[model samples]
Target: MRKLILFDLDGTLVDIFDEHINSFIRMEKEVFGVDIAPEDMIKNIGHPARVVIAGPLLERGIDPKVIEKRMETAYQSYKKQLGKALKRIGEDVVLPGVFRLLEVLSQRGEILGLITGNISTVGMLILERTGLVKYFKVHSFGDVAAKRSQMIERAVELAEEKYGFTIKKEDVFIVGDSIPDIRGGKEFGCKTIAVATGLTKGSDLEKEKPDFLFSSLENTEEVLKAFGDQI
Candidate 1:
């Protein structure tokens, strides 16, 4: 049986948390004529863009109903302008060992998918820019869900449909760099692999007790080993 390997975007595959935040800032200012302070959404990097942006809006006493409607507009605006913003300011988003690991996995014929907090448009832009989009056959984005577990569920369904195969939850590995990713994988009964290459500390990730944990994906060989006999 082929394992369905799902990856998270942003800090997991690409180190673009700063760029991501900047894009959000640019979107708010350019589209809505609103300026958000950097600190408002900086620390909440790994969360869904909707949730991340909502925090400061809510803190400012924006009505929940108004924010929801505005968020939808922001989502669309963000998608449209993201490409330009990224091209203008985005740096090398790919992280260490990312290419090697993806290459090895593809060569070995593992089914690859993406489950990211970014909406599909932003996620695809980032992936395409990095030349990483070709590797994935399935995708689940944050626009479909407010939580990571729901995104994982959506990815599982898409993978089954796209690849024409059923997958055991245990054979599905959710690899990411955040507490939400780890917890979501656990909640959905899939194997979790935590990499501490993002905002979360190693100790914090350790406490989540993922099936596998790595300080960074830079060690490609060891990470593959952690995938067990399936690799």
Candidate 2:
């Protein structure tokens, strides 16, 4: 089938775990001067960066405008740090079989889009660093929409606008490692494929009962089969 596969960038396709944690730590310590539990901090991730950084500050009674200004300053630091961060991610950061999977899908004429919680710039930077940029033609960024479901919806809408053709929900697939990915895909009426390549395990993803689930996308043939490959 010629499917439009919208992929979650961070944990599903590329491993940005280190950069994510470091950036959050810097933002909290330097910008907010607060220490956040890892779990608390991570829960903020996979959303818009501004929203993620502002949640804790807002809870501490920080003014919304002040939080905005602080985020602007913090974003500058994030951009600078990303230059160094890019050096650490490459083929290693790309999950196993990602390249092969992308290549095969492309050859089969399937559309590939990106749906990511990282802001547009950071998301593009990560893709460039991982050599995954060329695979995606469209994207719905976290900065543009705070919710993953919104991003998924945007991806479909943008694709339709770009191609001037309606996309069937059954022909759409959302692939990610997080619960939000599954929830967003399910809510948006796309088949969800949960890959346990991130913090979430296969056992956990199973409870979500996505249309398809895998420990990882290491097996390209099997991954293709999950999509009911007709090519």
Candidate 3:
């Protein structure tokens, strides 16, 4: 029997803050003819691009249907540009000690998966480009659900379906860098581990009451130590 570990992508495995911010700025300018500050966009972290874009547009009194269409067009264009940039940059480097921890977990035969707010296509591109794709046997993307808890539930379902066995909530671990991730895991009765590698700080994540919290992936030893007894 294998324990399932699901990870978030953007802030978990890749350092794409700059790329994401720039992309959003470009998209806003192209779509709305207004340049948005990167800071403004960063505040929308942990949310889907559509939601982020729609929120601002709605606040500005833009028609919902028009905003949705323009946002989608802008996002698609930005995606294409970001994809090219990623190809040029090659695989995003694995967080410190992440590769080592992954190797240890693989050797120990633990099942790994992905549960992220990114769409399937974008998540696949990020994982495949980052060389982390092989580590996950299953994945659930934002497109599957509008909420984080729903995504986690879907991932569990996929895991059971793919591996031919049911996984208890307690046997599933959710690792991510946002309050939503922690809250979703808690709601689903999965062990939650919050990492500070993303936009959220350790102090902020503490408020969510996750099972564990870490500064970054460099502390994989401590993370493994925390999970060792259970496995």
Candidate 3 lDDT over residue span 116-156, tens digit each: 76667777888888888889898988666777888889989
lDDT of 2: 0.83
Q: List the candidate 3 regions with Cα displacement exceeding 4 Å.
A: 70-75, 229-231
Provide the RMSD of all predictions against the true structure, rounded to 1 decimal.
2.0, 1.9, 2.1
Relative to the true structure, candidate 3 has a C-alpha RMSD (angstroms) of 2.1
| Highest-scoring model, lDDT | 1
Backbone clash tally (model 2) = 0
Off by over 4 Å in 1: 30-34, 88-91, 229-231
Name the regions of candidate 2 deviating beyond 4 angstroms: 59-65
Q: Please, what are the lDDT tens digits per residue for candidate 2 over residues 46-91?
A: 6667777787777778788887777777776666666577777687
- TM-score, candidate 3, is 0.91
Provide the clashing-pair count of each candidate structure: 0, 0, 0
Clashing pairs in 2: none
As a TM-score, model 1 comes out at 0.92
Weakest 10 consecutive residues of candidate 3 by summed lDDT = 88-97
lDDT of each: 0.84, 0.83, 0.78
Error of 3 at 160 (Å): 0.7
Kindly indicate the candidate among 1 and 2 with the higher TM-score. 1
